[model samples]
Target: MELPEPDTASDDAMDSFLDKFQSQPYRGGFHKDQWEEEFEKIPLFMKKAPSEIDPKKNPDLACLQSIIFDEERSPEEQARTYKGEGNDYFKEKDYKKAVISYTEGLKKKCADPDLNAVLYTNRAAAQYYLGNFRSALNDVTAARKLKPCHLKAIVRGALCHLELRNYVEAVNWCDEGLQIDATEKKLLEMRAKADKLKRTEQRDIRKAKSKEKKEQNQNEAVLQAIKVYFEDEDRAELYQVSPKSTLLQVLQHPRYSVKALTPAFLVCVGSSAFCRNYFRGRKVHQVK
Candidate 1:
């Protein structure tokens, strides 16, 4: 199919190019008589392959696309084409487009385990590059399910786990991978890093538990040492108490009426019947 001439730099350049194009006789070498090939050499025709065909604007590009995407191709063949397209985008570092292409390949349901696994793994790589660690992890899981022991998927899954700070899981995944290939340096390194982080996390948890236990013990001791007293006007007198279970015993002591206190001992009857009937049972709690 024929493509239009390349656009020129300016009006003057366009007029000059037209004059030269019209006046010159055919002396083509490599692209002799191949108009599409010659037009492609202009860096304008199909330089960026159209994602969708538009024959009106880019007939050559559209024709190229139509030829490549005929109905004769099977689902598996189309899927493999998408996979190759994704790989090309990946090599160019166009990760977002690569992910789109890979996702399309997966949607084909090619019924080819190897192809599907590779598609998932490739899409996972693209997702990882985009900083979608959880999504990348999910893709790796799908890839692994399709083909267990897929080394690239295992490596990518471990990386995602590490990024998500699932330290223990990262270590376990690395270990699983190492079991498949003990000489894998990437797995060995990841395992070492994950194991160290997991150990640190465990140590920090243990330290926090110990500190909490110590504080609790100290608070309990303080509660045990608090002395009970009964105040009569401004004169305070000690109330009988035991070292252990002092508050419990005092609250649960045999019935004692606040009004029955000796004149020297003063106790106000509380508003509530339960509170007035029981010895003052409110606890002023303090925890360290």
Candidate 2:
């Protein structure tokens, strides 16, 4: 077949290059013309080709639609192409574009459970990176629903819940995910934090309850002591009796056992001995 004649300007440029290259006399057996002929056969080598930019066009939804209808490319290849583009977008941190690419890929090959989980999981990661925790959780949930055995998705979902301050749900998700893959370090860490928070909250609640109980008990004790003091004849009569009468009664009372009251009366005796010892040591040190 007669290939289209080379463009005349390209042909002239090639001839000029070869002429200049051959004019170097010391370079022998270079076969500059033959080399030029061979180079010309390649479409790109002949000239500086015009740049072909992929126009900054809106996503070609039509092309995607046609790809869906076309039976030529295997479903796997189509998915691969979409996923490759999606990954490229992800690397660029263009998460919205990446999600679109992954979603389109999923539409083509919905039956691939692993791929579905991976796409959704990746989208969830992007969402999380973008600080859209709720959306990320949704994607993770969708992924887990499709592939119930997806441990990574479960962990990521738990993390998302944790960021959203749903501590109980986060712990629940981590617990379930750990049931499947216990060695997941991040899941364990997240669960530990959630449990710690729960414990701290519980401790605060218990402390409050204990404080109220103590106050109630103290109030009840004060009431009982007041009632006893008012009703007891010795105390009540002491209030009415003169000091001399009380003293006489104390001296005369048969139940005023000094031995029984000895321990109670010695409450300050131990402290007095310790204070004397401490004061003597201070005095000796000052003298030294």
Candidate 3:
């Protein structure tokens, strides 16, 4: 049986219907084109393209096999690749980038103790340069845990504490480093620097405290002088005396008796000219 001749009108209608269905707004399926546009807007560093990050597809079997087979494609090699990249950034003083590279190397999870220690220490160095002292200290501490005698880690940890103004911790870390390699020039130098800084800081604190105490003592002395002068009926009358008022003029005031003036009091009043001046300038004090 021969099929009926195709109807051009119905064929065009069917084509139009299929075209509308195909072009209908996607409800939730992955839209690669739209995703690409949005993905492009993200920073290059933040964008992990699917092809580059598919764990199932790109399993690190080569790295694992190298560890098992002792081949060059080892985890160490992979970790070192990122570590070397970090070192290059560090040398160029690109500390932020160095931190990123070091972090990526650490994510490789290499089992080599020395490599892990170096990775952590190098990251700490980058963090130090970036003024992330707390983060640097944390990384250095991790390095120390891995290899307690790691000289670079010890030095960096001490410096991190120093930057944080934790002089005591800085001194402690420096001393620990010194215990390992007493002759190591950098350790020795850092220890001495930390010690000197700690001493200087302590001295400054003492000086500040001493100055505060001296000010307090001086204030107490002034208050004592004021209290003594005001409480004495004989000297209380002198408080009203003007700076230019003479001793003889003050003595002649009705509030004081001529007989009440002691020889020492008269001598003090005559020498200073004014009670306030006498109280302020004289170390010896007497009131009657």
Candidate 4:
């Protein structure tokens, strides 16, 4: 492409601008009040970079900016470029910007499994640093789908599971990572930690279940005794039942069947205020 010749007409204009500078010094452009506009134009003072860079407005940056996301490039190439940009941001610890760049790379939907997996894993790292563990885990899952034995993805997934308190799942993921690279130190350490947590959780569960079962058995025993005393009259003891009855089932039962009809004996089943109150409230014959 031929470079456009500089307009000679601009020479006359440039001379006039220089002539004005020598004749009547330009005060308006140099004034402190006009400096605010210049400050606003600088990127350092600006809150954010312009989304759209106009060549006329930013001629210096136009070429570089245009080349950064050239529409002529293939999606795969564009995605790769974005990955590089993301990596730069990641190295600088600008994780939020890195996540945005990686997301843009993924949006390209490149057919290269390796490139896509890398983008996913990189995004997972950014999200992880940003405290979005679930999002990081999801990105890790995507990376693993593209490359099932991805050690980084496995490590990230295990970490996410650990944060979420899914100790068993974390151990499983750590195991998967160890399978691919047995010598990986991170995987080894994570697996050991996760395994310990999983075992502790299981032991606690077992203890809780055993204690619950014991309590249930005791409650069932108490209920069964109550049933025998109230419904199965023959299960009552000799003094608990009518003193006239003669049955082995009466001597074998453990429930209280208080207030015998005869005065020969008083059935006071040990320190039971509830039973005493109930007996007092009853209209049945009471023998002192």
Models 1 onward score TM values of 0.63, 0.48, 0.52, 0.61
The sequence of per-residue lDDT tens digits that candidate 3 reaches over residues 1-288 is 999998999999999988988999757554676876554434352343232334354345334334533435667887888898789788888899889988988887889989999999999998988888999999999998999999899999988988898988988998898888888787677778878898999999999999999999998766444322222344443333343556666566455454435622332233334755655644433332
Candidate order (lDDT): 4, 1, 3, 2
lDDT of each: 0.77, 0.68, 0.73, 0.78
TM-score-based ranking: 1, 4, 3, 2
Give the local distance difference test score of model 1: 0.77
Residue 54, candidate 1: Cα error in Å is 4.6
Candidate number achieving the greatest TM-score relative to the actual structure? 1
Residue-pair clashes per candidate, as listed? 0, 0, 0, 0
Q: Which stretches in model 1 have alpha-carbon errors above 4 Å?
A: 1-55, 222-288
- Could you tell me which 10 consecutive residues in candidate 3 have the lowest summed lDDT? 263-272
Q: Model 2: per-residue lDDT, tens digit, 38-156?
A: 45434445352122322233124334446654668876667767777778778878888787787777778756777878888888987888888998999999999899879989989
Stretches of candidate 4 exceeding 4 Å from the true structure: 1-59, 217-288
- Model 2's alpha-carbon lDDT is 0.68
Per-residue alpha-carbon lDDT of candidate 1 for residues 1-288, written as tens digits (9 for 90 to 100): 899776656877889988998899657655657776657643254465656655776666666667766658887998899999999999989999999999988888888998999999999999999999999999999999999999999999999999999999999899889889999999999999998998999999999999999999999877654443333322222343444544444544443224454323223323446534444553322111
